[model samples]
Target: MRWFLTVLGVLFGITVFLFLDYALPSRQTVRITNTYNRLTDIGANAIFYASADAGTVQNAAGQRDVRFIDTVRPNGRPYVYRNEDTGWIWPPYFKYDSSNLHAQATDRKSTSANPEWVSVTSYGWRVSWLSIYPNAISIRSVAGPDVRPFNWPAVLILLVLGVLLFMLWRMWNQFHERSIEPAIRSADEAWDRIDAQADAARDRARGRVSRWWDWVRGR
Candidate 1:
């Protein structure tokens, strides 16, 4: 049972990690190569992309013009990202700044020869098999690709999770000390008192029986 519980805990932790990794924004230092939009019908992969703009209709077509940012990493590999407003659900970015971000990405476009580095803040994975790209949250020009952004979001998430776990631990300890342990101790004491009463009653009955036997033998 202990091993089973340990395995279950490990799986839960992994699931949480993957969910956060896909949901939280991370920084990527790359050079903007292009910016464009395309109209495509979202089928099964609709979940990978952000939802339709707020107050928009939903239908079987699932068709929308998705803005994209094309970038190349420092190692000259291409990275594509989708710029979309997350609306009021899902990842909860609450970001509705696709137009401004697209303009920024287009303005910062650089060629391989000049290679202007920029930090692209995004969340989600670029899984080719899944036909999904990370959603770019924001971007800014940087001096070079060697500079890495500090992951404040991850730090904050960890801090909040840590505090929650600590509180839970404290609550469990207090429950044992104040409730469970005391209840068990009271039960044990009650049982001991009951056993003493039974023994005393038996002794009194035996004394009465001996007195009756002695009077019969004397008469």
Candidate 2:
């Protein structure tokens, strides 16, 4: 019985561990990305505008054939838009591309570096972008931190099982204790009754022997 209890306890512990490790989302991460490209010949002086009903932007790469990469968001919504007429293209996901633009190119040796023309705005779940034409904007995905919520049902079940096991252990102990007590009491009672019977028999024998001796002497 002791060994059985020990085994049951061990199994319960293992079950709890497995449920938490695999069944529960102890750690989670999310990232979201959005990309846009300019279709019109809006010169460097003019700003390019692109709107997405829902999403986010990370970083932009390349001036013309730009590529954007980002993590998926927790909410899991990302959108992409492209201008069909200008040959401008924006991928819904991460990809590489190479294309030429009529706009001024930023030179590696130039003193006045071209501004990192990237803009990010968050309006609830929607993201928008604006930039000069002949250009493409790549918005990387967003990344979210890991999180884990406690599993109440599993916890409750474990608790209940633990309580039941404890109760069984207590009951077993009580039963053994009670069983021994009754057996011991019965043995003691039987010994007492036997002793009483032996004493009565001895007294009766002495009385008969004494009476017989007196009769013979008197005769």
Question: What is the lDDT of every predicted structure here?
Answer: 0.88, 0.39
For candidate 1, write residues 1-219 as lDDT tens digits. Answer: 999999999999999989988887799999999999987567798888876554333456777678899999998789999988887888888888889999999999989888889999899999877778899999988889898988798678779989999999999999999999999999999999999999999999999999999999999
Question: In model 1, what lDDT does residue 77 have?
Answer: 89
Q: 77 in model 1: Cα distance from truth in Å?
A: 1.3
Lowest-lDDT window of 10 residues in candidate 1?
51-60
**Once superposed on the true structure, which residue ranges of model 2 sit more than 4 Å away at CA?**
1-145, 184-219
Q: What are the C-alpha RMSDs, in order, of all predicted structures?
A: 4.8, 22.8
Off by over 4 Å in 1: 52-59, 183-219
Cα-based TM-score, every candidate: 0.78, 0.23
For model 2 the local lDDT of residue 165 reads 83
* The candidate that achieves the highest TM-score relative to the unseen native structure: 1
